[model samples]
Target: MIIKKTKTILATTMTSAMLLPSAVLGKEDGRRVLEEVIVTAQKRAQSLQEIPMSVSAISGDMATDAAIVDTTDLVQYTPNVKFTAANPAYSSTSIRGFGTPPLAQNLEPSVGLVIDGVSYGRSTFTNDAVFDLERLEVLRGPQGTLFGKNTVAGVLNFTTAAPSFDLSGYINVAEESLDGKRYEAALGFPIIDDVLAARISWRKRDKSFGLYNTTRNNEEEQFKDESMRLKLDWFPFEGGEINLLAFKSDFESVGNGMQHSHITPSGFQVYREADPQTEDDEFNNTRATNAPTFTSRFSEAIALKMSVDTGDNWVFRNASLTAIASRAQVDTPYLLDSDFGPVNALSLETDGPDRYKQEQFELRYTADSDVLFGWGDSVDWVIGMFVGESHATVTQFARQNLTGLAQLAPLIAEGRGVPNAGAAEVAALNALIGAVPNGEQDVFAVNYVRVFAESYALFAQADWHLSSSLTTSLGIRLGKETKDGANGSFANTPVPALVAGQENFDNEGSKKEYEVSPKLAVSWSPSDELTVFGNIAKGFKSGGYSG
Candidate 1:
């Protein structure tokens, strides 16, 4: 009997209005007011009401109240945002129907994720657990110029809380059904009063699997995760400050709860569904898989930021200069059942270790007078530069059972009615059967891939306050990237003909690409309660070789 079934998960995103202080309002009505939200969506600190863009900001308190632990949960509170996980190591995201599939390691994400002013290059980093955050900002639409490349859809920016001079600490613990438990703690204090401060935070989570494995007689997809962060702030001199952050995380899981549901034969429209009671069920109520799966990941990062304020003494009055440097590393390994059946047929394993580093600097000059650009204090601008590099190495191995293939070949031949099979065919079958020595199959294939990428950009954005009610903005970015890749694969088999064109394959390649993205926008505030804006922008994503 052949049966087919499909399953889907419904996702939702929400937006809530914030109440600002009543002092900003002209009249004191009984109506509840919304608080003013300040954000850096345009690379500067400004009131959300002043910026002419679609943005959603979530405070740390809100995230904690809702138990938002990861990007998947964070998206549910933002409008038009969705997150899908293909596995523990891969995830895809979309904003306003514009997104990229996490189909391959070399594929770049359409959305950009930035933390503490440092941009993350890979989608895998999006899965990092969230903790001790000051706020989270989701910027919709093409952030072409100021945000740089790979932001065709939108940007997710996270800002961690800064250290305070006053000593403070907090701890939280929670337990829920399904053996889920969480613990988090944070402490902040002054190292030197009014000059230096530090904050430290840690979190741990343990959860049981959501699915039951009948074959193993245990719950699958169990997980344990730990994360830590340290932050420091220094006020070296008047109008200057330095901030540093370091973070580390470790995650391990027994299984991902992926069940085999169906098998389809070649040239057949119908497929046979795995029996729910026989180790191939796909329902949430009952599930079964014969193979043991495991996954582990570890990551760490460090970043430094410095900002200096140059008073009206310079020609570029009220000037502020900023610089940032950061480095991060990630390592992951996993094993899965390739055949997904009670019968032993195949297994797959992969190990990957990746490193990423970046350096950035920016300088913004606000006119004290109409001396420099003749626009006076009505115009403000910023110029910046960025350089980043990433290297990744991945190894994969697969094992297949020759005995199973040998047992199925005769039936296939018989079903096809091939009388007096040729000697070559018989020899091939004998070779396959013979390769399974010592009651086990041989290694089917081993593959390796390494990629190194380097990228840099020069960008600038300027805003012109044409009048009290209107503003105009223009921005542009010039970026270039280069990548080098190396790949090789080897297959094991006794039959020389069967192994032909499958062993000792190696290749190396390189590519270089450049792009220019620009943006223009106009905003008008008709009243304190209403704002209108329109923008035209170009989006770009770099191209790279597939693994």
Candidate 2:
């Protein structure tokens, strides 16, 4: 009897433990009902089911559990979305098979990226690490109606956690076998009861060795990344609130992540003889290079947002006014090995500092009235205006190394009627040739480009509740964009005669374009559990210079 009682007790304990989570998850009669999600995909808070569009949302907890640290990691969970990146400066996001190539720096992105109501003008901004987020939202299809310009494909919206009156915090740490580690933490507290609050979050990551470099006896693709964010909320008066946000992010890499997957006969004979470890097998994680490469970016931004709720205004009831202003800057400095080999051949580096700066402001008004001039029982409408300016400067240099020139001395000598030179004589001649200025130019060419852009847009959207179960929405946007840019390539060879065939050009251009985008959508909900929606939208993108 004692043995039987012990067995029964063990079984009961195991069953209770297995069912505890389900019981706490709001199970009703053994049926688990999913929690409702609220989103701002249409510029207002509504249930995810009520949004008449294709949308996806990932909560902060889910993202943390899945180890999603950047925009690229979201592809696995979102359908018809893909991300491609050769480096931080060269990255692209495609939705529904529509995307712009990342090589065109001056061009606009087809997909828009917005964080806390500030839209990023460039796609490279997507490379920044994301942490302490409340939720991430992705809207597929054209979003030009309310999102303004350059949203030909879709939009990505990130909403960070706000300051709370309660004290809360969390720390997360992750480690791997390959010397990779990540640390993240966040804290929120009330500074002065319910009137003022603040929240801060940070993340740091580093990897010592992700790939081997046999020629230099070092590692490739080693990187360190860190990001910090601060948020403050102040309620100074009745029906008014202000939010201040500041953030900074930095990423540094020692070497570019690249390797040879195939080798030609001549390449194999040359590279293999120089370094026996050189192989075409990319999976081997080995590379041969004499030129050290590097890439780094530092970005920072600050935003101020204020909102006021107007009660029973003369022309509007239950109306709100919101305004936001933000400024941001990003600097990317990089070096590249042009030859990608053991030979001390050609290289490329930024000639000077590369900087991109932007500023933007937006003002919006939303009103929900019980009666809309007898048009419907209830109606909601939104109107907004946006203006922004951006400026960028980029300069680069292509350099030729002396050792690379020495390797070609013998061949040049042979062509110059000195074919009978022996091995010792050839070595002496090579050394003499490399020591001379005429052998190779230190600065082969310099590429310089500058771009400036200004834009203004006005947009409006309204939703009419025709009946208890039917609704319709119409949105339109009018935008004007202007761009001015200058680009030039100059040959700076020490001996101009040596590069007589080098091409050079200086060009300047400007463009002004106007766009009109509109959208129409309809939805019918017969019950709370089901909603059917359909929409058609148009998109546009302005023209710009690229090289």
Candidate 3:
């Protein structure tokens, strides 16, 4: 009876396997076969099953099939991963219940994002549209040894399709509801036959606003995006390869459909809820204003990687070295309705604009040798050093109107109908208005914040095989980070006495921190089909001031 049950289970599994796509499944002897997945979770190419860490890898084809254009779409398919977007320019990603809020420019992300082996310092850049990808690997846990600092949660690695020697190209077009349209295309060919190759890709997206504004008799939340990338590969000589990448992206959007839920006792209000599924046009409160809310972002990046082989030796056999350099810049300008009501209570805009720049350099060496006193067949190890610098400038301006203040003054005055109901009140209001040069809306506050950071790290990891069936790995990373910041605020009000402590102020500070992360893991494989693994690791994320 037990044998019959086992046979039934195996048959069911085989039937399910046959139903899967041929690209995801292998065929051998006219039978369905499970294919092995290759990954670089440990900074080296290896089979997914051979790695002892928990990881999820999604192929570009699978992403395209699912119509996944951004990081938020990945949450639906990945377990223990969550993505939240405060706006198109800011997002937070969490893995294993560890994450940070994307509220300020000075804050750092706990989860790290890596593209083509170069790490991104800011989470704002992670939500960009994805195109021409080879694979995306989500490594769950503290990947401090291989990825360095700010990887307390995990690491997301995106590998783009490489340039091919053969001519190849593809074009994809998609249309969706709300007049949304998307186009993507790629082309690859050889420039110097087997010595050099190039690939270029382009993507564009346009979508209509999903929310209707009854006050304005129009819509909000519309967006248009465009991006392009170029990649080049050169085999300058034997045992050496060089890769160069350049990318540029631009994103533009209209007002967000954020709505005001409640007003505080002091007439202060904030956005609390916005329901996109609601068909009622009046549900969203937006004022009809000549100044349309706008958000624009432009980003550009350049990266280079070179890999060379160093001749073999008794201690460092099969040695190879890799070097990487990358630089990126982002600029953004935003304007929004701060009150979220159908009245011109408060309007917020960037004082000037927001700007960010980052640069990084890394060098890594890897080898397979009997460095562990000839303990096993071979010892695989890697060592690397990284240096990075980032700078950010952000500013905001809030404008408040007398019309909005009058709407709230009545409620604050108890039985008073309006600010002009009595002669004394009218005179006081007139006096306040006269204090302003324009006798119109005044700048409530001007906030300016700047941040500068520099970081350096040394990391190493090694795997020692106790025997053919058992292996152990040890890794460590030592890092130091320093940050300098300035936050200043200037309040422009008609009546300064009424708003105490709202004067001009400036605060400057600096911080320096160091951390050491370590990891140990053991894996035992008694048979080819079964393996058991255990690991212990420590991780930490850097801290910074809130602007």
Rank by lDDT, highest first. 2, 3, 1
Identify the runs in model 1 with alpha carbons over 4 angstroms from their true place.
Answer: 1-29, 210-220, 258-290, 351-377, 404-431, 435-440, 494-504
Q: Which candidate would rank higher by lDDT, 2 or 3? A: 2
TM-score per candidate: 0.83, 0.86, 0.86
Best by lDDT: 2
Predicted candidate 1 versus true structure: per-residue lDDT over 1-547, tens digit per residue: 0111111111222223222311233334777556677889888888887776678888887888888777788788888988877665666778888777765555667888888887877766665537887788888878868887788888888887779999987899999677899898999999999999999999898998577766667877788989899999999999999999888889888876576555334201111122235533466644555568887778788888888887665445677788888888777777887655544546778744433334444333333223235543376777788787878776777666665444334434545776553344446656767765665565467777777778888888878787787887888988887878778777665332363335667888787778688888777777776767767777777665454
Which ten residues in a row are the worst by lDDT in model 3?
1-10
Model 1 is weakest, by summed lDDT over 10 consecutive residues, at 1-10
Residue-by-residue lDDT tens digits, candidate 3, 325-420? 999988888888765555555677888768889999999999887746756766788999999999988887877665454554433353455444
**What is the clash count for each candidate, in the order shown?**
5, 0, 0
lDDT for 470 in candidate 2 is 75
TM-score result, candidate 2: 0.86
